[model samples]
Target: MNFDTKHIVILTPGFAASEEDSTTIPAMQVYLKTLIKATPKLNITIISFQFPFTTQTYNWNGITVIPLNGKNSKIKKLFIWHKANRVLKKLNLENPISVLHSFWIGECSFLGDKFAENNKLKHIVTAMGQDVCKKNRYVFHLRKSKSKIITLSQNHHDILLVNHHLESEIIPWFIDKNDFPNLKENKIDILGVGSLSKIKNYPLFIQIIREVVKEKPELKVEIIGEGKAYFKIKRMIKTHNLQNTITLTGKLSRIKVLEKMSESKILVHTSTYESFGFIFAEALYAGMHIISFDVGARKSIEEWYICSTLEMFKITCLNIINKIENKKTRIVLNCPENTINLYSNLYDSNF
Candidate 1:
């Protein structure tokens, strides 16, 4: 009922369960939290379409969180649309909703597009990572709403342009400098950070680790993430007898991940594809040497070596390991706020 504050609706797959919830979507938790701090006048309603969400309506730093399946049910997915439409109707009656934005090009985009069309509001959808590369049927809607789509990097832009023939804008991710720690320590030889998904190519990371240990017997390799391939990657480590050299920490808090990064020497990112590799940015900020597969954040991160192939990655690692292994350096990265502010202004403008 407050006309003074503009209401913007955001549809996401899942959000942090609460302000203190760090296990899910940590980057987005930090992102929206920072965005709210910078822009206090906007009222954000985050509709998390979590199939098995435990909580219903809650407050996250003043933002309203409405989870779809707040209670566990067998047929929750069956009635998701009905639940979403009911919420949308209630929201429209309460306030003049300005914008409907979705983070992915799938179901959320469908909901946002429909809501925007029916309510006569602005709709924007973001194509992230494999969403643009994979065969997503809903992405066809972006061709009609070409200007309203925002991607993460030029690589993604090119992919969208070539794959789907959809021209869009770019908005890179930004890190708040206040969050990083000022620690200088080297406890690990090589580090791989990301989920154990097929897209991350963790098996290839294991192969590289196996190769690296042959040269450096005393090397320490640690992977800090968890996914469906936990057992598969564990099997690889066991089969290769890398029990001493390689260790998987299995999903730590964001602060702990950054702390672990600060204590590591090198970060090896072997992802098949990424729109904006936020982990690389965090690693470079922690001053760790990075050997990535020329994906997102490859051009912006300092002291990061890009490799076209896994062989090149191994060669680059062999060349740089000893020089920086003993010392942990904190690289001063320049994450501009212009783009971030532009996004904030766009959201405020309700477009």
Candidate 2:
């Protein structure tokens, strides 16, 4: 099974339909572009297990994408996997795949396992957030198998080892500093990013905002992103009588989000769980103060105002508001180059 060592196949849940599409995973789009930039001679083929699953080949940023229609019901998706397998076999015959990289551990890993076994290709899965959680049943078998696994943070790495006896490569997600806009003058007092779903815990974020707003009457809070908890968050804001002080901007483009980050003073992330808080890194880079719970990003950055208790978070918020009025510089650092280098090194490896 000698093949072009530089060629690789990437499988993911969703990817941006194009550069302008903001709905896809931001990290995945960046990863694909960076892969091409890091390995100039590499050939990339992306297979998506998501919508518009037409069995056709299309080019996105010079990478070929093959989607087998899996956006249907459970039974249809099950059949789509076998259909995808046939499409993949044709791809291998045309251009031998060097490696199979699954972005998440469930269906992608299952497909990766079958594809690699048939093609005799090396395989790896990046165990992201909930994919390696207790409920994803595939973790135990995926870990026991020979397939290599990688995690974005040590928290998830430890979870894999403790729960499944799996040791995974720790590869942090890298954000190219050059991609971000320069920080502008802070216009808003607080900001929240990420979905408005239950796990994101937007209600808690609103509570923290409420706490800080009480201390600084002029300060205001803004949230970006939308989900099932939209009306729930709205109801909470109304119940708290924060109609004028708090604002929900709905979902915005990544560029627009960065622009908004530049205009904000603090980022309050109240999520109960995070594989890696990309917004924490982005907000920090934008020179905004970050107050977040003990999660994945807690271990990576040192300057963030990490809070363990709600009481502590409220105190931290008030203290930050005081600093804002007094005028103090925020702490921030550039993205980790080593993280990108590690992934690039993996791409360059023969295995």
Candidate 3:
């Protein structure tokens, strides 16, 4: 290893388990990739420790990925702490590992804190939606950690402070400008991205589509991605007789999703909770108007129109649709290079 090049270890869920970015794996990859692209002065190596299910060697840009799994047993659950610390220790021996970062601060948080404390390494853990929202207060409180925990929005940070009794810095996620395309000459009606999960509330999105179609027959709502709530959302679409007005595009590549964003007039983020609304940031970077339910970590978006209830989301959607009809063009947003550079500096400082 180059003496000046820093080795950075990121503990996340299995990337091989899922397709990409939907979970922690790809999101971390995206951020690292952006950092490398925006700042070449830094030389960094990233090692990602995934769940036991992962058995593959993957590379992101120039970063080397090492996948490891944990044993499946009652003892294994209790022993995961030791197992994770062992893995981090083993990796540190090969290179000058300086910093340890993790996306979720619960299961992985303890592991990161343990590794950093044992080895005297700098550590940073981020609390995504599930960590601070879905996880019970008692559980989070019990797993208290001293590592700097990062949150994507002030709302989630407040939630963390209240629930976990911990203060978290708000570091919002960013979408690259290249991820978006020039606004399509002919705009489509609506686009939504996310798994067909219960928290996404796709059924409610369908109902809003039905209400929109009543006024504008040309209006359409297209949902991208499949999940546990897939068939349920489809059923709602069929029940509302929105076969023509609503469409589910299933899972799509990041570029393909961006293409859909380019064609759409607006993007709706209906998730009940999110750490940082990735799709919402992508939509904003794609220059599409967004009317989202006021839940989750959507700090990248302006808080001019926030709706806390389904009824409010419906009203806001209708209003945004009307504005879309009259506006000559949508806003184009460019993510700051400094934001990307921050990750690069942190990665390089790991040395």
Candidate 4:
């Protein structure tokens, strides 16, 4: 163990199975890689509670990862937590962990908060996605603990403050410019990327696209992702005879998805809620116009329009497709280093 290096433990529900497993959680994968590059002296250890369905420890991009394989079984949750506490104790003995950072405000945060309090160490919990808005009894425990809370965007911060009355720092996620390939020729006119979940509201996406194609019948659109809503969304496309207008490519690798964004002209995000839309940042970096509901960071970047209603969403898509609105390729948030620095400060803070 290197005494001079700082050891930071990360707790999450799941993580990439391997370096090649880019589809698991693309934003988290990018963030962790950037963190390592930004601070080479920092040591990162991940303890995933339930994912990859394996108990074996492995290395991901030089970072040590230990998966508990909880399998999301409520009957086994207590046993998993006890096992995780033992692992934390062992790691603290080895390197004296500087901080415990947990993703999401659920089980991981709950466990991290308890462990950090008992050990008198620093803990930080990031409210990711629906955790800020959804009902979670764990939030009450976290609010009482010494753990510092962080949110991804202003929208998320506000939601947390209003819903849970918890104050938090806002650190937006960024895209690494080096990961993108050279700009390719635009082959797709409209694009959508995300899980095919009901919360993503793909039905509204289909409705807007159905309207857009009435004027521009030859529009080329693609939705890249896979989930329970696949068959339902596919059936809707066929029912509306949009088989020629829209194509569901299912799920693609993160690199492939970025390539698709590069080859696309516009991105339509129909999600009902978003803590912070990482895809929006990716689309902006890929030089694509984005039309989405006023969710996530909702930064006022050029070529990105926020719509209030389905009619507005339809109009915005058509306007961009017909060139009624000017388009520009802009990178709104490009400083992953700043995000890393913010977390580094948090890890070193006395509070």
Best lDDT among the predictions, by candidate number: 4
Q: Which stretches of candidate 1 lie over 4 Å from their true place?
A: 1-3, 70-75, 300-302, 324-336, 348-351
- lDDT over C-alpha atoms for residue 241 of model 2: 88
Candidate with better TM-score, 2 vs 3: 2
What ranges in model 3 sit over 4 Å off?
1-5, 16-26, 38-53, 69-83, 134-144, 297-304, 324-334, 341-351
TM-score of 4: 0.96
Q: Please give the lDDT score for candidate 1.
A: 0.78
Clashes of 4: 0
lDDT of 1 by residue, 1-351 (tens): 232567888888778876666667655666777777766777889888863365468888898988896343446754776787788889989977877878878778887888888777888787767788648888877666622888877888888788888877888776666777876667887999888888999988988888878888998999989999999999999999999999889988888888888888889999978888888768877888888876775674447888877688778778777573444566644354665576766765545
Q: Estimate each model's TM-score.
A: 0.92, 0.92, 0.84, 0.96
Best candidate, TM-score = 4
Q: What are the per-residue Cα lDDT tens digits for candidate 4 across 1-351?
A: 232578999999999999999788778888899888777778899999999799999999989999999999999999999999999999999988889999999999999998999999899998889998748777899667888999999999999999989999998888878778777778899999999999999999999989888888889999999999999999999999999889889888888998898889899999989999999888998988889888997878767899988899888887777774344465756588788888888888886
lDDT of 4 at 326: 43
lDDT of residue 205 for candidate 2: 83
User: Between prediction 1 and prediction 3, which has the larger lDDT?
Assistant: 1
Ranking by lDDT: 4, 1, 2, 3
Pull out the clashing pairs in model 2: none
Of the candidates numbered 2 and 4, which has the greater lDDT value? 4
Worst 10 residues of 3 by lDDT: 324-333
Listed per model in order, the count of residue pairs whose N, CA or C atoms clash below 3 Å is 0, 0, 1, 0
